[model samples]
Target chain A: MSTDTVETIRTTVPVGAQYAPGSLLDWSEALVPGDIVLDERVAPNAPWSAVVRAGDVLTIVDVGGNQSADCLMFNAHDTSERYSVPDTLTWQGNAYVREGTVLRSGLGRPLMTVVGNEIDRQDTIGGACSKESNTLRYGHHTAYQHGCRENFLAEASRHGLTSRDLVSNLNWFMNVPVEADGALGIVDGLSAPGRRVAIRADMDVLVIVSNCPQMNNPCNEFNPTPLRMIVTRNEDTVR
Target chain B: MVGARDTASVLAARADARAQGSNVSDWMPYLPAASSPFAPEGVDPSALVWAETVAPGGYTHKVVARGTRLRLEDVTGDACAHVLVFNALEPWERLNVADTQKIPWQAYLGAGHPLLSGEGRVLATVVADTSAHHDAFCGTSSDEWNVVKYGDAAPQGPSPSGRALLTLAGVKHGLTPRDLPPSVSFFQGVRVEDDGALAWQGSAGPGTYVDLVAEMPLIVLVANVPHPLDPRTDYVVGPLRVHAWRGDPSGPADEHYSASPERERAYLNTTDYLEARGL
Candidate 1:
């Protein structure tokens, strides 16, 4: 919450720096007006879930490049039916979800499909952190710090849901790769400022998101930042 | 199986860690340890503990004593019980995956493996596993999947989701979403190939089962469903039967302990804590 803590959110990389977020500025800069239904800015480490109707679109903007947006989805009509990581990978025949990939539910149905992506690939295997995990991975000092689990709990409670509803999540703009030795690494993201991903609701669905607050891993570069959620429809004409 | 020298080191390390504020590092050696297994003096599940069948789209949570043997048997094939465990006395201590894999150097959970807590304490051990390859990493089914695959919307033949069921059960225990940690999916199968890719497979058969013996008092939760990766087209998977009973105190060495020195050390650490507290 402090300026010093915020400063750690992102340290500008010089042009052509090894992982300088390249060309992400184009999406944010080139974006024109569309019928905006909902415009919300999520804080550095907050959880937000909403219903996105079929034919509607949800655009996630990385206001701060490298911020990881951990997400989970369910059929708005049936909370029991939710996202399936294995089906998405198996159906797409790929591990890392990317542009044009369909986000499948557990029964192998499409809940939403990625129509746009500024980040190259999203993480499905690497999971969100919790107080217990923070204590386990970083140390006891971090146990008191906020995490996605807490964010999800605070947000999900408003919907009458609890831990049983939590599942594997999608990490947009986060870079986690399985290594040659089969070891998993949470590395610094290739996403730059203004980089974004857009998903079209294939059916009415619930989208829950946690602007990850993890500072221990490279995913956020040890600094978490805010994100923007833009819900829009193609039929809505700009006034 | 814990050697005398091992017990001494466990005590010394724990004391040293406490003095230096140990939860800050990979103080695996200094993590909380369990006492000897709890052996129910005289308790019958059908009478004292618990015996119940979880129908489709349902789950349950209960606190049972150490030495409790949790028998999970699927009435039909392709059943999954997503489970999470916590130390009943100290709720803050819950299962931790990072240590489970790194400590025993096991990438895949198998019979004779200890389910670890954040502090590297033992939560449960897979003493018996008839379903050889239960999913260790993949999670459970969800709402969108149920609708997409079965056209069952919520509030009707609502899709079956282990996550949702777990939550409904968690509320009864006063556990919140923060307590909903990653779980061990039972009765499912997933295999990692030589190319570093993961493959999804179905369960063994009806009646396939696994038994978990708690090494300490445990708050256990179960989600009755199939793995999210289950290639079933139907939303309805299968029913599961859970039977809890007391275990043998003088039972042979912990399966995991006898299997490896690392695991034996883990048990020793648990014993050190129990002994120090004089439990």
Candidate 2:
């Protein structure tokens, strides 16, 4: 046998949950007692949307390991000013989104701020997968497969948004690294089961989430899983 | 397998044709000798390498050398020029619109801003701009959306979509549809309001133009199509005039090279790469 050895660089490993699905009542450690307002589990390859109130916290849980959650945000009052990847990345002077990063809007206003993070990084590039891109990247056989763009369209349509309203979005738990020569690659995720990140709404924002259904790339490890979303409101700050 | 003899004869004929000069004109560099009337001021007419007018709903692709300045003019008041840029040496390193907007710390692109790459290098710089109406947020129009808006969105049909046109342009360069990314649009504008609403600002007027100096060998693709946000019922657009001339790339001595710490780093990254390659 050859003396060469292959070394695998594993970025993510299974981690136990800090707050399991049935343990929301015990989340007083993070939020005040009885502050849990909404807790919903989004199925794999599904789309979820909700209006996260200003000052409220929305926690996203990677229930199943290596799931990519493609997300878009807009000002709840006016859907026109949406999440701006350029503003967010430029103002932060960083490519990856992490704890303490303020997600900015196209108007250069803060839409949400990451208060807690468990994963190493998040993606601001690596736009949501679409049928056209899927067909291009894979082949014509995948032209009709459901994609994140369709999920976004289906969810956004409920709010009266059209295809023209879609914008480049954020990818939580997705690992997209830019090489030294500026080659963008969507590789395996850096998120593990039970890992979570929490964001506080700086304004009343409409958050849309599409658990990425991309089976063509390693971003989902060829197997997508469900995600959990929990909204908590502080009693002391309730107006 | 069914027609082995015919296939062999066809291959022999193709080889014979290749041995001659029959395939010499398969693809030729677009090096036009004529000068353009719309060439911007300060551009030497003698140094111009290409000049052409792309019809409405048409597209064009060209690989320009480093330091080549490209001027795109809206001949009519309703034209939207959707453009994509890629490093000619390595097509994988294309324009990163997010980095382009963010690194400059300005969401609204104008003169003096550099189009950055994902690896923190300056691919091109907006040396001159008169049409302040440009968009870095919304990309080009899609075929499905175009079909919904118009009756048809075929690449050869009337009212061609920007994505379809760009795809064709990419195909001409041995690139597939996946090579196309979210592009930056010029001559049409969209601004976010105080209430977080995106407001569409149509073209400024005829003859409005924007100039870009390529900091690296770049494959630039442009599609002159109607803005997706345009509220017009008809697929109306105007022709786009393109002019390119040899120019000097920015260096450490340039004022824009040190405009900001971020920009300085990007410029340094670009220079370092070029120096390493002895280019």
Candidate 3:
């Protein structure tokens, strides 16, 4: 749990400088399902991108529900310092994460804080998907299922990370409950058709994700959807 | 006929019992009885192997895993099990609608019944349950999964079709993105639908459960990977005897019991190979 006394302010009030719809451009066309979009104003992955200063709000919107977005965050200055899920859970004292949980780093430091949430926050416990796995679980015959692994590999290419960098991830919009018997369950989306979660970068962080495109189960009801991103400048910056 | 008052009274008692968590079977789905915790011999502790051979568009047994094998008899004949394995370790991997489409498996498997994965791996096999000689390629759906080829023209009861079974498997396995995998169905037959329209046909039945063997150790991982490719056609692996640990002074159980030097040497080399790879 963080004890740092930081004044909180709402950017929605007083009409903060908004990244208008048209003004905002996706590097990829139309932000379709299974695509990754990063705002240029913030730090990018690898070569250890510069730290995003305090009060920077990052918004990731699931254009639809039941779509999973894997996320990972790291300290900009310290390479080893990374996000800690256990600490985040303890900090909130609640298993479910919503608008207001400040994600702590592995070093017990604040990395990013959930500023605003338009949808039900997802699971941090579930990890990402891959291919060799695709073959092993399903029979060898249906081996070519395109999934999040391909997405991460594609995205990681830009950052110079091969398979090594792929580690545990946060399945945003995914809901997993730990049962009394210590069993884990993947529940349906509590998020509506269209939902979004916003986080303020405490520092320049490296985030990676694989917009999950799995059709095997009802997590997405076999229909992959899209997502949008918006970065808003603090209201004080405008006036 | 039991009068309306009697029926209503019974229903009320059943509901009250359920609300209090008392076990009752009046409203239970297709099963002889509520699953019991006790395991019978020749069966695995957490799994049920089906005996009857099912075809495309066919379904049997609502719940079958925890300690019994519901062997499909392949009643009508050869069929395919277009299955999807989920994660009992992490239930969130159970299934995803958008993911299926985004990955384009929805289109590829829409009528073809592609298997899903947690962490991206094929989790189950879809064995045919109906007789239409359905193409080995299409995927299955929910609402539009209307064409069911039954043995006889009886009342069209809503049974758990291949699609429903896939969903149930996802729930049972606690599937998630991490446990994800591509899937294949057994006794496959069906034409691919360009627009997702399914054409039913003849299929295998009774005495078929894919006879899937677990390649992994953990229940969570085991639950997600579907059954193996048919042994008759595909390359088959082992009926391996696993020991509690490596380097046991007794060696592997089989070798220890048989006192076979050859088996002991095989175990030693395998251990060395694994250690060399840092696995």
Candidate 4:
């Protein structure tokens, strides 16, 4: 096949950001002047939430690599509508989230769309770790350890939400593969330092993230690391 | 009857009250009723292997052989049955709700849909469904959620949550809370609107049922509690009726087994595994 034919085959499905012709940094650096809006670094095992306005692109950077970013999204106008893993996976006809995947809500509406993704696959079914589950899986000693569930509770509380508001979340950069025997295994990640995935908000969305603090699994490679969050808008679409 | 007596005398009387016979009847299949009101066509009452009635906010777990048909009934209009399934041979191979939904490319589960595992095997098939209102998303309520809403959520309390009940049931089978994955809820429904809002659909009234035929040897856990999205203020729920009978696994001739390419492949995978083991 010709080079163009190969490129066509690769582009038929939305390729991961890493497979793009240019690096994420190269693409971001080419943006118009003054389009950058917010830039922040989240500490390991921390919780963060922000409102990424419609039309803005939120880029998540794996600063130290192999760290899982557990995330939940909600409509800024209506908390009743939030990300739905089943809807997202069913509509896409694929199990993993990748570029061009529309992050759908429980109502089957798009909340956000993946504009870029460095990781080849992202986990939507490997639920966030909880204190109770950690204790049950690892040991009672892990009961005292903070988990993604705690982080979500703390951050969601700031937005007037509670435990009932929590749902299965997306784990970016984490590797949880389903084996041939129907078992899910959380193995080492496929991400590396400086890898990035960018998603554009289809509507005003309240994005809650937990820099995973899991120490009992390879999800974080046993050591948590910091992450970078950058929001940028297209210059011509600036409002 | 023994008259009112001292504690020692009463204890001696109780010890002597034991039935003097072999306990073989306990293991024998006896027909409690002539027939099941909800049994599908051609299913004989004598084929029933087990029957149970789980009270509101109660739970139960059982291990059934492959092809066993389990019928779950909402005995009242307010019952919600949250169900989980695992491969009995390998507990780690449990139901994957995401694959169950995504593999069939259908988010709303109903009759003719196969419940899939993460490794792409069918654990069971929804052979029949009378209550079309089922939920494959928004798993059962948690203790924290129940406490926030009802002020109490102990497993044996007045208002028990499904998560707590399932956890307790899991312990009975040597499984733990970690073994339980996201479960499917029957009798309570949820629909997403055009603008992304979730609307709750309550039960389809008493007598509604769903039948699941196991495609593999399975450990099934069920907790009958109020759905988390249920809008009721008072913690009111009804009883669930469970009935199981021996049946044959879905073959290529079965409609559900050949419902879709995805389901067909899953059934094939299950057959391959079972055949290799001489099951």
- Clash count of each predicted structure: 17, 1, 141, 2
Poorest 10 consecutive residues by lDDT, candidate 4 chain A? A14-23
lDDT of 2 at B81: 90
- For candidate 2, the per-residue lDDT at A171 reads 87
- Candidate 3's displacement at residue B125, Å, is 25
First chain TM-score, candidate 2: 0.85
lDDT of 3 by residue, A1-239 (tens): 11122245665533211122222222222222222234532111101122344555656665445566667676655544555553454334444567777776533357888876755556764445555344433433434655566667677556654443443456777765544322344557766544667777777676655656655544454555544555555644222
Tens-digit lDDT track for model 4 on A1-239?
A: 11112233433432221222221221122122337788887767889999989888888888667789999999999986788775575455455788889998755578889888888787776767766455434555565777888899999999998664676689988976654223355779999767788888899999999999888777776667777888889865444
DockQ of each: 0.08, 0.04, 0.03, 0.05
Model 3 lDDT on a 0 to 1 scale: 0.40
The reply for model 4, stretches above 4 Å from the true place, is A1-239, B1-42
Candidate 3 accuracy as TM-score: 0.39
Residue-level lDDT tens digits of model 1 in B184-259: 7887776655444567767788877788888888899887775766676666567777767767421335455657
Docking tier of model 1: it is incorrect
Docking quality category of candidate 4 according to DockQ thresholds:
incorrect
The DockQ value obtained for model 3 is 0.03
lDDT of 3 by residue, B1-279 (tens): 245323356777676557766554321222222232222335543343222212233333222221121222222244344443333333334333223322222222322232333333222222223332322222332222222222221113332333334444444444322233223333333332222223333334433223322111123211111122122322111111110111112224432212322223323432343346552
lDDT of 1: 0.68
Chain A TM-scores of all predicted models: 0.84, 0.85, 0.69, 0.85
lDDT over C-alpha atoms for residue B58 of model 4: 86
